[model samples]
Target: MPFDQPLPREVKVTDSASLFRLEERACDLSLNSRLDPAWVRANAALDGAHYLWPALWNSLAHRPEVPRQLRCELLITLRAGDRVVSWLDVLPADFNPLPRVTSREEGMQVSQLLDRAPSVREWLLREGGGSGQQ
Candidate 1:
């Protein structure tokens, strides 16, 4: 589906976590919306990978210009049977870090998270994963 495709109803986001969970849930509702939580974990350029994944997702889901290659990888990973129960599960067991969006401001948190995602940066470079493709 295109980014412009509207769902039947909108998810109200009262907080960053809620917004994150809603987007994650949306990913499961359709293959067109699925994301590779593992790839987000490994490639996001954040100190606390666990929290930033959802924040980034919530932010990007609104935008129209997500890199085609990144979208393809997210969809491809789903077909490979990579299931993510929670963003928490994406982190290493020893990874104990505070939430990135403690202020409960979804927009600010989303901006900060996307600013730190290496894959987002790589996509911006237009090299498609800093190579021909990722």
Candidate 2:
């Protein structure tokens, strides 16, 4: 599938999981708050802040074809006083047949991320993608 084109009907994400993911992302996007010093301090670090988890999940689910060799970046911005800071996280995926097609590498990659939900949740509450750090 070409990046410029849309997902095919079979994987277009019409099911509950995909739809919910999209909704979650929308919520994350809408949850941005002004980053006051107190807010930053409460969060420990400005970089610790994220756009919300739903956004991250939705983002990943929305574009399920991230190239393995390439690093993916998702940026979330916060307004701290007069400064707007950006936090970046990665959503790594491999869209090739490695160790042959239908291999477990892809599954493991996704599973590894899913296992880090605590960090991802914190991230969702704080910059955008689920990684705890920028």
- Scored by lDDT, the top model is 1
Off by over 4 Å in 1: 1-27, 31-34, 45-127, 130-134
lDDT of candidate 2 over 1-134, digit per residue (tens): 33454321110102222223333433343322222223333333234222211112123444445321211121223233222222222122221111221335744443343344343246546556333321
For model 2 the local lDDT of residue 74 reads: 19
**What are the lDDT scores of the predictions, listed in order?**
0.31, 0.29
Candidate with maximal TM-score: 1
Question: 19-40, model 1: which lDDT tens digit per residue?
Answer: 2343354454332433343444
Question: How far out, in Å, is residue 6 in model 1?
Answer: 16
Superposed on all Cα atoms, model 2 deviates from the true structure by an RMSD in Å of: 14.6
Ten-residue stretch with the least lDDT total in model 1: 69-78
Candidate 1, number of clashes: 0
